[model samples]
Target: MILHTFTLTLGSTRPIYGSAHELRGFFATKFTEYTELHQHNADKFIYRYPVVQYKMIENVPTVIGINEGAEVLKQIFNDYQEIRLGENTYQIVERGISLKDEEFGISDKIHSYVFMTPWLALNQENYRKFYTLKGKPERDEFMRKILTGNILSMAKSLNYDVPGQIKCDTNVRFQKDRLKDVSVMVFSGKFHTNFLIPDLLGIGKSVSRGFGAVQQLKANNEGGSTCSSSSTQGAPT
Candidate 1:
């Protein structure tokens, strides 16, 4: 399947300091007509894969649009000249936009990826189950399943039918994090999977707020496996 992706990066005169959630709020409020920007319909949350994701890469405000979201991004690429975040308004000095068609599906080779941001892999229920596991082996296996499910969810959202089962292995460490003032557990690590995912795409929960952004590292030879390295802690941008 060909996944259509659009990325927009904004540069300001000075450093921009804000969370992806704040950045999203700026756009969702400005483009209230575009429900995809915020994934909301009349105060009710739309529970599906988010086509549009907000992020802060290297302290720069970035927005990613997938498939239908890509078209919406194109229509509003030039609609704004400035952005406001928490009482600070920054003038947009540079705008970078990219549109590409990327291959998306199961591959024969195992591809490695690192989480550029924290992966919100567990919810309250899953957190209890995860802790109940006996040892590292059990926990690792559990996380692998979660990772595979994340990939399948993304494929389903894109309407792509997977012909084969996805295989995933993860090397992650748990960390304490907070989401929306609630304490939560997050992971920072790398995983190897047969599924091919676009760079900067997110997985797991609260992805619209920039959690779980992944960057591809390398792809091993077909039918070969690559081990994942220990991941360091990373805070959300």
Candidate 2:
């Protein structure tokens, strides 16, 4: 999996919410061509994988660009400096870029995994219906099925073909603060993990704006069999 993360450290400290929207707006101003591609894809109702995704981490607007997007971002932002977010203008004080692959401790084999971001698994119709329906138990069960299916669909779209029935367990919590009800899910089970490709690739709806971004929280150890993951106790980002 070839993935590159570009962390644009900002000079401002003011609280900036709805960063995904701001990031998209910035791309529209500077990278109009790519921005148009994003809009076009969204309108087409296609599964065309988004190469670039943006999120705010530690007051820094980080762009996790994969494959072609990585090259584009490096070319544009490498020489260009500074980007604005919302009402507050931020100076690009520092820029950090790094790549992650097999050497980065990501296992090729399948194993239990957790999400670094919430996993959104519904479309426009299903999403609205899900919220309108009553009963937490039924909602939770439906969420698990949809999420697992979405993962499989994502893998297929990425050319990671897995045969037969794939089993997975999901533990998720609904985050109401987002644009809608997004589920923060931890997925565990056995399957090929190599096809997941890009680190922090968004899975479901609004992926271009960073809705379903995920990171592997576990990796197979040197033993090639045992998986290792640290216990992170904190609120979901």
Candidate 3:
């Protein structure tokens, strides 16, 4: 996997919100009009996993991982050298793409993980699952189930065996009309080789729009093996 990062100096630093939506629109308009991942041919439609993922951090549009899908936008943006983000036009200060190592920064030993971007654990259907929990204990128990299920789903997506035991901190955050969690997963089994690289692959839902983004945290001997967790519910967006 390759990660392409675009650094832009916005005309004003007014703290842009809903940046993911803006970034998504910018690429969709510049690259292709179709909302679904497909290319229209004379008589057939070809489909494949869209390898492009992007999010704005500190006003920079960072392309999480690059592939056939990302190359088109990369070329045009780098060449054209300017972008219109909302009412402000951003001048590209610098751009670079780096190859991602597959190791996921873990050795044979146990390690901890963290969410660099908020991990959306629930979509519209499951939002009530967490909401109905009455107290901390109930909420925490529900969180474990969601996190474990999320981990298993992610593993299955990559064709890896489900870990016998998964431990994580119950850190939940709400943003952008999404229920997100930033927790650590400690796999009891051998860590998958592909995870060694800190690829910002979204885990739960709406990953194509940059939700559920997770990354490996630096290992430490201080924390307990059990997953530490937290959750916060924001006002309705």
Question: Each model's TM-score, in the order given?
Answer: 0.91, 0.67, 0.63
In the range 1-237, model 2's lDDT, one tens digit per residue, is 333444333343444444775876687567666643244443463345566677665445667665566666766765455567776666555666766542222344554444545555565656676778689766655654565555555544445445434333445566543553544333222222332334556666566666666655466322121111221111121
Better of 2 and 3 by lDDT: 2
Error of 2 at 175 (Å): 3.4
Clashes of each: 0, 0, 17
lDDT minimum window of 10 residues, candidate 1: 228-237
Report lDDT per candidate. 0.83, 0.52, 0.47
The clash number for model 2 is 0
Worst 10 residues of 2 by lDDT: 226-235
Ranking by TM-score: 1, 2, 3
Q: What are the RMSD figures for all models against the true structure?
A: 5.1, 7.9, 8.2
Model 1, 108: alpha-carbon shift in Å?
A: 1.3
Write candidate 1's Cα lDDT for 1-237 as tens digits.
888999999999999988899999999999999989999999998887888999998889999999999999999978989999878999999999999999888887788889998999876777888999999888887787677667777777778887876766888999988888889999998888888889999988889999999998865533223222222111121
